[model samples]
Target: MTTATPHLLPGTEIAIESLPKVSLHDHLDGGLRPQTIIELADAIGLELPATDAAALGAWFAEKSDSGSLVEYLKTFDVTTAVMQTREGLERVAREFVLDLAADGVVWGEIRWAPEQHLTRGLSLDETVEAVQAGLDAGVEEARGAGHRIRVGQLVSAMRHADRGREIAELALRHRDRGVVGFDIAGAEAGFPAGRMRDAFDLLAASFFPATVHAGEADGLESIRGALLDGRALRLGHGVRLLEDITLTEEGGSTIATLGPVAEWVKDRQIALETSPSSNLQTGAIAAWGDAMVDHPLDLFYQLGFRVTVNTDNRLMSATTLSRELALVAEAFAYDLDDLLALQLNAAQAAFLPVEDREALMDTLIDGFEGAL
Candidate 1:
């Protein structure tokens, strides 16, 4: 499914890859290039299931498509294994940006847990600095290539671990650098955001923004903790929040009622970073259905919620932001206006200053207008 050149949508005769986009929930460890993974593994004397790039790429997709979160997460072990050193982190970060720029991403936020990459004797601060250096290099390279892209790091803490406070402090220490926000990621079923209340309190005290991973593997209660306890500004793949919305058939029309949790999220316009492909693979939307058309994205959009499209794990999902947009467009018959709305939603929710967000909005508008 990998291509050397851009792919075009069949009927529209438009190159979706050429449209400017924003990526909000992308993962650093989950987006490593297959070729880079092979090379890194070789350097570390690690063995992989497939030595060839194409086969290794296929392996990741197969593992992720098993429809089990446990199976899906196993692929990350391979990717993160090679990302334990400064060189590996820098290379992966730089190439990740390059790939995003090539896919017409104008702005993106790359999230990863710093604590996960410290196995090779690198300090948390060193890991962040190395990733920042790589991101800076990639931005400059993209600029030189006439592709303007800006990326910020959203430092994440593993929910199953006890380093939320340490990771929150790490993010704040690098706030003036490339770090923009904080997040808690990992299995969300058993580990509630309330367990990390101290870290969230520290972040709230420091006035740092956060976007917690909730409502994916869990239900409404996890989302509740994310909002009330974690104080998350955004909900990563908050697709399961739909459980709080009750659809009633009355008078030949289906009426949807939002529970308090869903109401708060919708009323506050907390952006839902919905990744259709990844959601399907991980069964995040299994309650709704197994197809893209069955995703609650349309319902969320129709309800006036901030529903932004995202490619959560490009490598595992074997997808790009443009491909994701195309899938949703095909499923819901979204026109150019819908695409622009999603991009605008992401721009507005970005963890950037008002001036920077406005500047990004201008660029997105100009890009869409030019595409038209």
Candidate 2:
């Protein structure tokens, strides 16, 4: 299906795309329009596997669905190739916001590593500024179209790279200029958050919020590092925390026993930004199973963990926030209240200040209530 096509869940006449939503884990590089990628590649003289937008999109889905993280990441080479230039980055970021607006996202945090964009002669700071410009322009465009939406940048540093400190400083510099928070995005397995202690410390000194990618590619130890060292305000795709929970059959019903890590996360209400399709694609949930129904999101939710749904890579996973929600709703048999609880979890865990977060929660509650 095309990116514009709305995928409704079974038995729900209400289009999922019409429900107000919040997207916290979407990537700027991973949300590029296939048609935009083709044109941008053509503009920059880059070769692509498929010239047609539909075929190119299909190619991305197939590659990502291979259940190999390395192969899945290779798709970004094409998307990032087209996004190297200023105009490409601007256009992509602008369109990312517009697409999220269309998908009923009233607020979103678009995360990408600025260090990755410098291969085309742009400095790290310049890249952040360019993305900010695009975001501002997109917000204006959305307003012109009578869609009220707000987006912020989550400047991500490559965890394996040595430039974490620089990227953290860049985020701090741009904190008031559209950059909302800091993150470390790439290669979560070997690169623990402790490895970027200097960057995390710098951000901490500035009292900045950070969200680390943990429990997706790696397991509980990585999550430990994220909480202890990275001081992460949220866990990006932290689905594997379920591994620490032991389910025991007592009588006929099942009872969940939470390990220390899982208990800590649950007690603290650390939001798990679980991306269903991307989790399946990257084999993050391979230990659980291959299908969306097997995802640990339901377990976490049932256990009273702060569970929030996300689209980690929209282009690669070929999903929107609404689509991801619909998929999970179909698999777990969720109603509007379940969806609202997820949105409320996201709003509470949002990087916004307390007052703004309350406002967002109010907006979500009112929106969902009106729809009901």
| TM-score, per-candidate, Cα-based | 0.98, 0.98
| Model 1 ranges off by over 4 Å | 5-10
Error of 2 at 338 (Å): 0.4
What is candidate 1's lDDT per residue for 167-233, written digit by digit as tens? 9999999999999999999888899999899999999999999999999999999999999999988
lDDT of 2 by residue, 169-202 (tens): 9999999999999989877878899989999999
Which is the leading candidate under lDDT?
Answer: 1
Model 1 RMSD to the real structure?
A: 1.2
Superposed Cα deviation of residue 188, candidate 2 (Å): 1.7
Candidate 2 Cα errors over 4 Å, as ranges:
1-5
